[model samples]
Target: MGRKYLTLASALLLALCLNACGSRPGTVPPPSGGGEGEGSPLLTPASPDDCYWTAVRHESYNPSFDRTEVSTMPTEKWWADLYLNEDGTALFREVLGFGYASYLINVEWWLGADNVLRLTGEDYDGELVTMDGRMEKDRSVMLETPYGDRFYFEPAQKPDSGGALCIADLEGTWRMTGGEPGAGEKHMASLLNIERRWSDGEEGGYILRAEYYSARLLDTDTPQYETQKELLVEKREEALSDGFSGEPWSARLFSEESGAEYLAALTERNTLHLRRSDAPDGPQTVYTRSDSFLPETLTLTLADEPDDALIFYWRDPPAEVAQPLEALPMTALEKGGQNRILLVGRWYETDIQFCTGSAEQNADGTLGEWITDTVLYEGTLGIDEPQWFSLSIPEKNARLCLFMKRPWDESWFTWPITDQDPFLVSGNTFLTET
Candidate 1:
């Protein structure tokens, strides 16, 4: 039941190579009329007793290099899951992917006593593709297309009971929450709605619609836009093999638009965990079951005026011109029990300076000298993205200064500086007053 990863680019390359080689001898083709073929003693039809099987395919590429020569090398593998039912119906799930864009293709299959395996399925584009393969040693299935494309699959270990819950328990709407903390203001202000509807069938099929908004400016309280995607899913016990802990039942969701696969596990807390099959380390969002499917709007506003002590000055890279910006209030910090200043904004590598003493003002309204100035924090705001930061303040009413660095200039050491100036140079900075 362990999850397998594959790359799409490699899979495409393999398909191209197979097409160029031409069909091989001894490969079976599906009969024009669906029925039994001439029996083969050595390759009899797979018995219904051993109906469940898992298939896998793997591909890797490594370049061979020498002092004066270089060459490209490639390796390919194939796998699948074959399920034969007592009612004469068969199901075949083919795993495919490259990197984070991995998915499974479900196809209806049939095994002929003549050692031919017939597979018919609708691809992502809703086009039908039929193929046939010859069985080998009754333990392995080798499928091939008329274009000479071949895929091999061996028996896979059985999966454990996924959980106590069934697909019926997940047939409802859910509100999503709990992602990367301090990620950004937009992330904090956004909300997600997920609706699961079951289909009228014995296959325990369902459709999931995920609707989410991407807020451009958190301070404005308006979302930049909203996106909704539908995914097809089926209760899958094999999901337990991927080390998911929750109510035992699990499901696989396939997005036809992106051709990506996601594993969903419902926990006892009424939360559903979603993870992409290929990008295990990627962000995982938890969705809590909700009572209704109605969507909610999110609005953010400051509770009170920011204290003068909380004022900060920001300057873009090259540290040339200084701009004063107010921070957006965070509900988490407004509770007031914690002695930390939470700065939640989208920022690059930024330097923060705090003044231990109060700042004096001149007659012209310009700021005077600071009694004690110290760098409180200095580093990148987030990992690959702008995230929030919580800095412990020594005392209340301390002045804060911020300096954001622009992205590195790739052509700094080159001839012409082609790339546009870093985004931070726009003289805009995020800060909160409260």
Candidate 2:
């Protein structure tokens, strides 16, 4: 969930044309019903039964482990000594420029021991994440997995350098139950329902404000060259993967058929602001704490048994100069049976579309017009390190799309902030306390 390439000097080259199956070459015309849509506002007091839990399942657990023997065991760094203070084993050499290999992936699920939902840590890689998969709770129902992958624990008051301590409590209102950004590659899926407030001091500092609605699915399909000198050698390998192959992208490419609905306001703490229609002078995005975006904390020390999932720690970053993106091989996607909501990528404005589809729904609800296959992922995805992709949507209600096409220049130095990316998407909804 991180990618960067800016420090520009000079660049310009735009030429697109591809006609296949009679009219369907980068289509973008679907939003014509009325005029008032982003106005269902009202539900930010933080509400989700105020955080109630009773989901248990622990029949002597053993949900398949041996993924190559936990990939050669040994984990539990403990957030790199709670954010690396004493050099702490170099903490991956102080994060080697934040491209990302791993440093977090602890997601255990189960609720009903007086209600204790768990979320360990995240920050998979980096890309300034957030196309509405969900994140922005500093609390409603508990959430911390937007860019830094995932983190949410429910029973605190144990951190005296002891154990367990994660409480960001989601503020609420999220609905964008599916996705896939554009050309390159992005993922998404959302459905938050928070609204639990209670902040004063040590009850783990609570204050939620929930409200969700994000369906950011942009796609820019590529790969249709058979002539014109092989489409000019595939547009010079997509301009050397957008960074001029030498690593450079303080980019900008605009085109408007008139269609916008910005408003990504998280006011503080890694701030953000992009209000287009509900404008108060739109256009302002910020998020500072560099290392590409953020996510280099690794802390592991488990044995209490209930840690469930694991990958406890990781590291990579520092390793660039290999641009030219376009690799979709997981057997060209179409796995076994049902695990729906698959539209690999999308985002049209600054050019983005990796649209490939297969979303089924045929009843009275209406929504079955996605049988596509497009690819065009040239450059700038997750900066230097982090490179991991896995998808197995056996649909139990899912939607995952994360795309950010335009705007990047150190995000204008955190003007009210919100710069997140360090993604990790997991499922099978496991949480057994029986």
Q: Ten consecutive residues with minimal summed lDDT in candidate 2?
A: 226-235
Error of 2 at 352 (Å): 17
List the candidates' TM-scores in order: 0.31, 0.16
* Model 1: ten consecutive residues of lowest lDDT: 411-420
Q: Which lDDT values do the candidates have, in the order given?
A: 0.41, 0.22
Q: Candidate 1: TM-score?
A: 0.31
Give the per-residue Cα lDDT of candidate 2 at 53.
Answer: 18
